[model samples]
Target: MYILYIFRFFIQKEEGMSCCSFLDLTEADLNLMELNMDRTEFVVQEDGSLISECNDDPNASQRIRVRSDIQERRNTQSMTGTNKVPLHMFSRFGTVRATLLHRVAEGQALVLAANGSFTENNRRALMRILISELIKVHGSCYPPDEAKVALAQAIVTEFPLLRNTRTKKGYEHYYDEETRRGFIEYRLWNVRRTLSPSQKKYKTKALDSGKTTPVSPNINLLSQEELDSKIAWMKCTNPSDSNKQNIATHLQETLQNRRDWIIKKSPNISQILHEYPRLLDYNGEMINNEFRYFFKEKSVNFLARFPSYYCPRILEYAKLNRLDVYNRLKNITDVNLRALFILADLLRINNAMLAQQGDKGKGKMKGKKRQRSSEEAEMIEKEKIDVPSTFLVRFAGTPLPQSIQEASATGSIIIPPYIVCTQEENGRNSYFVQGDGWLIKPRNNNPVTAFDLLFKVYFALKICYPAGLQIFYNFIESYVYDLGTKARGVVTSLHVNLSNLKLDKIASEEFIFGS
Candidate 1:
């Protein structure tokens, strides 16, 4: 029998995700289900810890009858959330963290800390994690900055007495060896940032209702500035005492575990949102657009490639350690999921590089494969297009304001239509999917740059893909139409006569002037 397990993770924001996680286990996976409720078979203590011993009456702290019928139904239902996640996605890091985050946000986080691995960073990280989960469940406001700050304020206001701030002199103030005793003015960072009407309303609703959701601010702990200070101090002073190291190490582990747990447990956390719904709807559009600019042009040094439609989606999978992918690939299993958290921890180990290297078209450098069954790929591909017109995007007409920065590159891209041009036979067998789709390489392996994809598209599936899947059709159609615009930009015929090497580099870097 196939065992169905529903799970979650901790996604990080800035990347706009949470860091907690969970899992669903099918009845077949649970061996204890058949055991009839024999109270004498169990034991529990005052602290509610079940003692493992068979006595005349095994002490049970709390015994509530679990309906086997309800448990069976819970096992079979489809797990629902935003982000259109396929069930097969799995990440070692994602699974654990998602489970934790989901539990904590719902006020059911388990006590998994082992003797002092809980650092202040870990604690704040866990707290923030709960808040992110709330963001997902409640649907956070648009213009996240104002909404986020407003949320922070609501949280701050909840515990007026717990607020604390940094000194006016700053952290370096305490750096002086001799004058460490002077009274330093402390500056409190009151969570008074911008707030959208809806976010303010949500925070107010939660605060006034006397019910705290996950995203609600933590007024009880040190502020972000203070936490950073603590982290910084922890980093700066290498306590000679071995016990202090052990203590710091413990706190660090606890916090890391906490972060991982939350990230993996949450079902709704969307990671690396470069493009979805509206074209560049969130602030992440700029980096994504930059990638478009970087890859659209042909370059000699770079491999021939075009953008795949799933760039943002793939990025989410990568950073989020998509459980669907992990679960599907039995070969990889959950080993790599743990790898990411270990990776996060590994980063703390000094000069550790988590980047997996590969040879071109041979390894991950060749690329990673999508783990979904062909059926799933078809379903995802069938996803409705919510994007605006690409040609009409008119980057010149609108420039992103300076402050916003996106997370890592989604690395996947949406290739425009392949222009059907008759060419000499470079053929063996047809390499195109469906015998007539965009020729861009799949995201399963080493990422194909948009430049590399364009060439592949030129040779294969030479036709415009219709709307919804028009990313392919758009590229070739737009370029042919804009040929004159390219010609106009070329100042001199001699400049155009440059070698293929130089032309390719220039083209890849610039949007205009390329084959």
Candidate 2:
């Protein structure tokens, strides 16, 4: 089905060398990250499987011990011109772009079904709404230049028949934030048509019709003459009459909001972008948490798209939990609520996908398949793939084992080492730690509310503290609350933590401004 995963551990060593061994004794005096290193032995075959013994020499012992160690690290400050990879490969590497786009596209069916006049301006508005959503979900994946350029191009050309309308002429009048200029319509169409595959079909259709020129979209609800008549009728001879003023005011408001399947004017695509999109926001107003939670529980369409190749949570709880969550969300086929919930759920899932990327080339385990030696004699075929020992741990809002509960309760910093707990076996005590890795626990039980979580998230932004990782810890804490909220309300750890933290006013303003 579907689930979320976060990848923090991957390699115990780089280039067959233990990463922990190079740690100088002074490592203890350094970052909190460097001090915590307990190596775990994971078995890997030549095929990089944790399960298979199939090697060049079947008898050869090649169970590799991999130990991943996090070194003292901080966010490196970047100058104004620091270079990140270009945007073309965004979908290939991360789930952010793909996930966001999928949610935006959810409203396409209803949007296309809109009986409102199919003006070029209207379609452009839809495209702007699409781009706006893309910004919210995957803003960090691409630079502003790419998004702005792509938005301008995509908005204009998504439905090219609208290119010549009077509305289209106004497209360039509004300033775009990224380009620092109004959207230039002409070049965007050329560039987009050049890159898009739909170009071929469009050309063929033009030829099949044997038309001297492209056809114009027939707009029926309102015409230039009708609009001018209406305007004149509103500015009547009874200018001083309150009834006339009221009629004119109502007419203007109606015209501003009216979307007919036949009219031909639109303000700017962005003007109506927020109101129409059903997935993320409704005309700039965010969907209420009530409807969001209601539908998210009822569908998992968002989860099924999770990158299973990297998301261990999808694979780990493939049958038990995550799949069910995804299925539940997906089952909700309502276009409106479903679209919004899917967006929120996808955001949650994609966060896990990004986390998994950090685990690449790290501590991995191999699976083994049985191999048959063939000669003149017939041999039986058998195979087994080695499953990687490295697991993508999901710090979701699920209850933890008793061991984790105890560890979480003592929320204090101490000597960094793998805490070996004593497990009783046949009346004898044996000491062992799971492995060299971190054990994640929720901070409380009421699944962290979006408000509290968002506050913590952007708080660091206002404080100018590097906080790409604030979400990770906040989520863990939220899950803790989710798991425990029902059993213990006030005494739960998350609520206590929430009560203790005093947020300053500047933090609130920064959140408002999104700086």
Candidate 3:
């Protein structure tokens, strides 16, 4: 009788009919069905039948189902469509649900109850598994908003009790559209945050944007032989009064060629120093000359306006705003240190304002929360200024180190065109310009001159301004150098600061002249 029943079950399965149609399945038979279902290995066919390898079947094919009726019901639902989740894709979730149901049927303890409600820990675990499977298909933790919504819909459809009816949509708790805050978005944010800098995809601004390109070299002016000879001479000759004039003249004649080499060829600082060794001259005369050649009249404006116009106005602005560093600024007598402090503070303030504005603009466009919460404001406030482009270091009767590595070892990265200020025995500050692997000591001991050299080198060498000091350099370019013509359309934090400075200047003038 047992053999006849087993043969009849095989005949029913072979005819694409459930064995339960012929005989009643006990709890042991249901448990056996659950244990035999290889959810991971099964593949759905074009006809919507889930098939897996069967060792006992003569055809080597077996139609598997979660239960006797699930396959028939799933097959009746149309699976062919764009943006439709495949039925087989939910097998893992179904398998997990079946296991939980089986445990509950057996009166075993579980985090998930038979009614589909689960503990917070179990819910998180399910979400993590779903997200992992989604990432496998989407190939990124940051899946499209649509895919996230679809997943949320699937979850709510499967478990009606988990659906949130409070919001406009039932799945908003899983993935909110307005604030872009919810379980999925929060998890994705964490995933992206944990990725290394190299793994993250970021949009970077072009190096030449909003800045003038260096003039192309006058290649026809000097023959290759003449250029080579001049470069060789500059490389070999030492800086002396008699040869200094010739070096300057040769440098002028070969100026375009040198600029071409630096700009077009884009050689590193070490290569530049190797090609034209005079760049490392103790007095930095050639460096200044090259800067003057590029900027011409604007070369002198930085020194002229910095102390008289910029410093006083900046200090006054800090005072009026009642900034934290105002008292510290008043106590610092060293003009160089005072200037560094101001630039650092300005950088921090500018970045914070920009971040706040960016967040506000995004919120407004998305029709989400417009006002920045205190947490957001605090995040902006906590932003640190970029490592100082120019800084001061005091030594106890020791000469400051010259190499980029030694000099920048304390806190900075010593990208070329960086400035280091040290106090001399004569109570004057000496500025050293760090190159790729070398340093240039300017003849002047003025902080303004140091800043001038720093800005000029960026243009002269065709190097991009350091990221931390971009706003500070932009202020110099737009205000000090009066090169705002190209950048007027783009209103930046620096522009706003400049506008405020102008307003303050006008207000002070009005008060002085009794307007």
Candidate 4:
């Protein structure tokens, strides 16, 4: 009867649906139903008899072996065990990419599900698993170039199809050494594929059609410039009349504000570049006209690719957060530095909130405030923390230019870390400092939402700060992602202390942006 039921189970099983299909284990190896006999450890011997082992009882350790067929039992009962599973097979690693890989390895699936689309979650999971695997094979301290090569090799090994798919106009465009490194870096740094308004609309329409086509063959083929051309072509031929004038106005105002801020912040671009020489490839001898020229050259016709809806949304976030400096000063030209500043400010804000929260308990019985007992007062004092004057603000979200990372590491780049005062456990205050490391990309073409960047910076700072010390965070306002339809607030942390602090083993490997 058990064998009959097992055959029925296989008949009912969906093709390419099971995650465990990747493993080479057969029905004989995994007899799930047979585990009902006992909850303790048991070993199967050459004669297929189960031998129980119990440290508590010497007699139980050598108990008579049961001659029951374990494979037959699997059909009737579920297997239960206390041993921890490998991290790769763990529930936490059960992401879309992992699932797809598992399915493919089982030889039941060849591509992503027809109805599935490439998503940020899939990108993040791929980056995470690949990074961890690479770190395991190569040391965590592998150089950036070497790491990319290792990652590419791993990719081809895990997904053999990726190797054969490499062609000039094929889906896999990273077969070349230079392009492969860039592609790997893009994934490692969490850079996303940027789409124009029309492209996004088309994608949404496709998804709404109730049929998810297989992953697009040309999904990652287009660059930002090519997308910009598409947007321009669409605008000239089929301009969107839905809030078109408003979007254009918003874009103009935003660009003007950024330009004004650049002038205000640094009247002479050369002087500012001189102060931060690492930001520039050449010496600061370039004139303002030359700087502007270079900026124009790099920007070209790429600005049109931005989703018109994104402009108004980002603007609203800027106003709500009172980020005049960021909104006014930042543009495609200095996006990298802008991202760094944004991250730094997020850390600073979190610190201030933490400090403020800590101050609440220190009031001296003024008005309706009650005086705390000696014990409570001592506890409060213990919670009060001194903010660090300066500390390292490491970039572990996305890889930056090698020169910039080197400068940040050597203390040549002066990013003053912020501080806050609060008493909170690591788990409680973790959100303010937890990010998946997909914050900013090298180009402004694929700008991240303020909501997204805030968390990235929070995680980056979380990587730098110690958890034993109390931390705090606050979000006065939130940024809307879907044109005000959905909003997300910034997550800030409590404090920073660059003292004689020692990071726990876990903390040391938490952030790996440019490592």
Candidate 5:
């Protein structure tokens, strides 16, 4: 007896009707079917034979199965079609541009404007179209860095005028590699905000997994009762007192407890200030004390080396490297301006060194493998350095209204601990520690001191170093602070630069002694 096993395959609809097809199962097909047992209903006998039950009316049973499979396929298609954007309709830019022009002009003759720049409305519409097409390929609103870079490159290639010449990479205005804040990122953020709760949860989890957790200090000397009492007293004390001796004493007494609380609880800036009001003291003694607590003797090393050691070496290095910024700032007489320029040059040099290393690695691979390896290396570099979490904003005038305004305009989030250096009307610079919509003016007027405090605050508070300046901060943490010698996450380029600087220092010392 020949037992025919009926299988229904749902094919594409023909003339608005579902088409059901059947295929003869060869031994190979049966093997494939065996691998995918979950998709089909089949019984395996004790002898290891596969069979499907048949009704008395085999033809009727087959017809019912065919109709059910076709209906199921139609339901699946309809559900997915409803969720998907009709990307095929406007995937081609020529078709989209023509359609947009026709609709906007209402079949009238439209002339090109002189500047050829898009208006706000036109830009929004264009971004929407581009994002839709991106989603079609990516299946998510968050496209990878490579995809974003490719899209930005394509845009600039097509429209050369849109290129931003000020940035190193002209396409940075569309998608900046360092800051990760550009037109595309802004649009993606907005899109993510509007996504369904389920989608947002998954995306949020993925993002949170990569975030660097703040490092808390291990010191917790005071008892819970003593800590609570000290916190209560500090909360009631005036932060702007002329004689801050009592407040400073209390702050010193509870330093370890405060750090432990801040690290373990992870309170916001507002809450932290509320508990320890002395953190907002005008002289910045409390802030300095916290730094001393964390680094001890190394706390003074930055101030000692910054002026006498680091500045001179950085300038010498910049000149040797023949950096363009060196020539520009070489003639600057102002101490602060010259120092700032040198720091900027150092960052540029570090970036170049890193890029050169990546390039050398990419040169080893060939053909299709070269392209894949290059992309993977780029992704690895991106992952190794997180996006900038802190910003250094400088402006003319005081920190209260002017510097804060400048920081906000530059898109820097002012949520405590970011450094702000303001040039007052008296030709003097004032360094302020911004804290949750408030400012703490440090007694020091030097920009370099402000940076030292900034780095210490990040360490004491367990904040991540800003990504763009990670190499610079790493050098400071290891060489200056004398901390985290064996810790992971120190970039290899940093060690090479440090070794070179050390050799230069030793050579200079020997020359002076011999002379």
Candidate 6:
């Protein structure tokens, strides 16, 4: 009987959210359902308390069903301007508070009769009823920010089962403070659900006409465009690259072998090495007419080492757009070395842009901006390209210089500040060793000064350490690409040699580089 009472109480209130008439369920109706009593089984005294006169009835239970009509009448009277207000009203907060208090009473009554855990459906119904009441009392712009924490508290108080548990021994941390806070925030988040324009119009039309009409059976709640967008967000359109996965299988085809071949006989590599530094500035004409092949080949080689470094689609994207490699790497004057780096960076930005666009369709972000016009909306719809879902590539790029490759391959599994012996010689190599690491320089026309050389050597020691060139490259990628434009600028401006900079010292300070 108690279980039936709890079930009916929640379902009837939940129905009120969709059809307001259910809010008028009389006390007599509740008594009939909860106590399973006929009209003769119980009587309501003048004070409105339930009583059973028949002593023959072995099971006697007293239940108090408060008048829902009181609150309904008060709400109606307020809407009709029958109640005068003071100089300052408490505003929306008062409504949320009152709704919470009412739910607490209802929840307490159910909890008293509830001996076991709540069913999932009943719990969901109760939450929906609470949310609907809050929304109703507070208007369309509901769940005012200030009341969310209090609301969560009310929920936990009413449904103690939702509370996080802590054992006496403290062996298990089932729901820590942070996680519980996240739970509260999740409940307070703005609810999103699908609603078709036709369905909404139907409801409004029925209300206005004061009559019901049969709805069209052919209406699609989810349009084809919306469905496709959702699918794109959830599934990757591009298939896995079988050729790229052959890297591990063909381990003998090392980058060292390729680099050696290029240096000895590849005329293209020879020509690029001579022209790269002198190519100096980015000239679109020069890139188009003379250097396009050089950039493509070098980029291919660089990309080979990390087989999965970029999506194959990125290359296709570049080809379709005719992205000027030299123009993009205008900041890195050592064009031969940084062309691939620039390409990788640009691809990352493009990927982020695609992800951002897809998020709008998912409605993951919230905004209060005015709606766009039909023409503007049409233009935006036309402009949105279907983005392929993707995962991080797992292939290595082209091989490094033999010495760099050997060093990198040795410490590949190590965390940063990865160090390796510069050469096979054990006796000659020492931690104090210098004059062997690579220098990272900005693209500029100025002559290489003594300070520049010193700066290069200094930063090399800080990054290279016993000497792993890959570590230096890794630092460049993470510090530059991972940072925003502003933070990247800060990194570029720190032109001073960092050879003596310690990893520990850097970690000790809080660098406000990126989120």
Q: Please list the C-alpha lDDT of all candidates, in the order they appear.
A: 0.26, 0.28, 0.52, 0.30, 0.51, 0.30
Candidate 2 lDDT (Cα, 0 to 1): 0.28
TM-score of 4: 0.21
Worst 10 residues of 5 by lDDT: 364-373
Give the per-residue lDDT digits (tens) of candidate 4, residues 1-515.
Answer: 12211111221223442322312245454475443323434444455433334446656544433223344233213211233223233112233245345434421232341122222233335545555433333322222454455445544455433332213332222223545433345443332234344433223221121221222344333455653454344334322455444434333323332233333342232333233222221111111123233244332221232123223322233333436646753652323223333433433433333333333433322211122223322322354422211221222343333543454456443222221112246522111111222112222112222223332232212212221122212221111111111111112100101111122232223222211
Best by TM-score, which number? 3
- Model 6 spans with C-alpha error above 4 angstroms: 1-64, 67-131, 139-515
- Model 4 worst lDDT run, 10 consecutive residues: 492-501
> Residue 501 of model 4: what lDDT?
17
For model 6 the local lDDT of residue 23 reads 35
Per-residue error for 69 in candidate 1, Å, reads: 30
Q: Global CA lDDT of candidate 5, please?
A: 0.51
Error of 3 at 184 (Å): 33
lDDT of 2 by residue, 97-198 (tens): 232344456445424422222322333444444444433323332234445545544433443322323233422222244334542332233334554464
Q: By lDDT, is 1 or 6 better?
A: 6
Worst 10 residues of 2 by lDDT: 372-381
Off by over 4 Å in 3: 1-221, 328-331, 349-386, 389-414, 425-428, 488-515
Ranking by lDDT: 3, 5, 4, 6, 2, 1
TM-score per prediction, in order, is 0.18, 0.18, 0.45, 0.21, 0.43, 0.22
Worst ten in a row by lDDT for model 1: 182-191
**Tens digits of per-residue lDDT for model 3, 60-93:** 4444334523433333232322235443343233
Model 6 residue 42 CA deviation (Å) reads 9.0
Candidate achieving higher lDDT, 1 or 5: 5
